[model samples]
Target: MSDSINIVLRFALYLDLMLLFGLAAFGLYSLRGQERVSGAQLPFAPLLATTAVLGGLLSLAAMVCMTWAMSGVSDWIELWPHIEMMVWETDVGLSWTLRMVALLLAGFAVTLNKRWPTASLGLVLLGGAVALATLAWAGHGAMDEGARRSWHFITDFLHLWAAGGWVGALAAFALLLRQSEPRLAVLARTLTGFETAGAVIVVVISVTGVINYLFIVGPSITGLLDSTYGQLLALKLTLFAVMLVFAALNRFHLSPLLENARQTGEHRVAVNALRRSMVLEFSVAVVILGFVAWLGTLSPEME
Candidate 1:
């Protein structure tokens, strides 16, 4: 039961941070100039501020949970010392401190949205990326020592960023397409821009994911099916492939359909088709994140 709760906390925190980073990045790259702040593109200030605040609070909860599980202390009096020691002495503690500081500054960044929109969003993106990257310390990479540790950590960071970017864009798309009267022109442009970003994101995720796997599981594929971690990873990879299919469909089929509908005056049908696919793709992405959170808790060898 405690393990389940820990997984839930980790999953929530992962989702929150990924969205916080991805959404900020999506706003910066997908939208242009006054379109960014006009309330027409995205409600940047309130949306980002809410995520930043939530991410920090969730981080605290997850940290406390980890401390409790590690120290086996029921009383606050005893747990307090353990918590303090972990916070000041360990690498996880340092990462948490940096993440909390970054999240706090993300709040301050949102305040600059009115006058310095670009800088504000850019800072928010940077903060979100940092916060997300720090989660690597809580993963399998943290169990390693020496130069392999650094390489693994670097790959983990890149993997997180790439995955976060893809997830964030899907969310932004679903939100935008959910409106009563979707903007066809803007949606068209955004989809095209996403095609470019999506390609890069896919490449980075694939490469770094392979590297991280090699670092953790080595060159062995024989024991993978016997381990719970590997089973979940297999499921994650299958879902990712499904997401890729949807992405290709969106790029090849729905996108072109929307373009044609724009000229033929049949916007409703085409837009709805694309919207359904986006929602489904986003749903699968969330499921994959859950598997990720669970896999992080298990051994990839024989557990």
Candidate 2:
């Protein structure tokens, strides 16, 4: 029961941080000045602020749950000493503390929109990346040591950011599609602007995914089939491939069609098509994250 709760919390946190980072980064790359914070393009300040605060709360709940699981203490008073020891004595604690701080920083960063929109967005990205990177501690990377540990951590970090970027972009597009006042020009620009970044995201996810697999499961690819973790991993990879198909359709087909429709002043067909594709892609991404959260809790070495 506790394990289930932990996985759910992790999934929520993962989604939260990814959006917090990916959307902010997307705004910087795709949206022009003032549009980012002026609520004219994307409601950057309010949305990010809400996500940041929720992340902090989720982090606290996960920490308390972890402390209970580790120490077998249910009461807050009894858990205090254990919490102190873990927070001060263990690397996991350190990472959790830093994650909390990053979330807080993001919360504060979002509030600075009036004074420094671009700077605030940059700060949010920094905070989101830090918070996201800290999740590596909860994964297989934490078990490694020495030089191999550093290398593994780097791969994990890159893999996370790339995945987050893709997830966040999907969410941003979905949100925009739902807007009452559809700015077709801005939508077209955003779709077109993301081509290069989208390619980079795919390449990074693929390369780092393979590197991460090698680090976690080694060369014994056939051995993985016997374990539940391996099964989930396989499912995740298959879904990712499906996700690629959607992306390709959007990029090579739907996006161009939208541009043509924009010129023709009749984009309802293209818009509706993109809306369906994005919803499906985002749904797949959600399932993948759930698998990720579950896989993190299971041992790949299970035979």
Candidate 3:
């Protein structure tokens, strides 16, 4: 029961942080000058602020759960000292402290978003990145020692950031498509920009993914096939492949159709198709995150 709660909390925290960072970064890069101004385009500021607050709360809950799991204590009073020890005397605690601080700054930055859009976005982006990257400290990377630990953390951080970028952009695309009457030109530009960004994100995720696998499972295909961790990873890769298919369809087929629809002023069909694809992609991303949360709880050796 406690394990289940921990996984759920981790999944929520990961998704929330990703969306908070991804959405803010997308607005900064995809939207043009006046479009970025408050209320001129997508309402990213409030959304990011809300996500940051939620992520902060989830982070706190996750910490409590972690302490409970480690200390084997369910009573709140009994758990207090254990929680304090974890918070003040461990790397996980240090990382959690950093994440909370970043989340608080991100939340505060949202208040300034309307008045200082550019600076606010930058703050949210930086804070979100730091908060997300700190998760590496509590994962498999933290199990290692010396320089290997550093390398593992670096790869883990990159992997999280790249995944966040892709997931967040998908969310932005979905929201844009759901708008009452989205601007065709703006949508077109956004799609084009996402395509470019997607390419880079894919490369980073792929490279870091392979490196992470090598670190976690080594060069043994047999190890992968024989272990539960390997099997779950295989499932994750399969879902990722399906997501790629949807992405490709959006880029190669739906995107061009949107371009034509923009020119002809008959984009309803294209828009609906792209919207459906984005929804599917986002759903798969969430499921992948679930698998990730579960995987994090398991050992690579299936022990």
Q: lDDT for each of the candidates?
A: 0.90, 0.92, 0.89
Stretches off by above 4 angstroms in model 3 are none
CA shift of 91, model 1, Å? 0.4
TM-score on alpha carbons, each prediction: 0.98, 0.98, 0.97
Cα RMSD of all models vs. native, in order, equals: 1.0, 1.0, 1.1
In model 1, which runs have C-alpha deviations exceeding 4 angstroms? none
Residues 79-183 of candidate 1 have per-residue lDDT tens digits of 999999989999999999999999998889999888888888899999999999999999999999999899889999999999999988998999889888888
Error of 2 at 246 (Å): 0.5
Residue range with the least summed lDDT across 10 consecutive positions in model 2? 32-41
Clash number by candidate, in order: 0, 0, 0
Candidate 3 clashes between residue pairs 3 or more apart in a chain or in different chains: none
Clash pairs (backbone) in predicted model 1:
none
Leading candidate by lDDT: 2
What RMSD does model 3 have? 1.1
Off by over 4 Å in 2: none
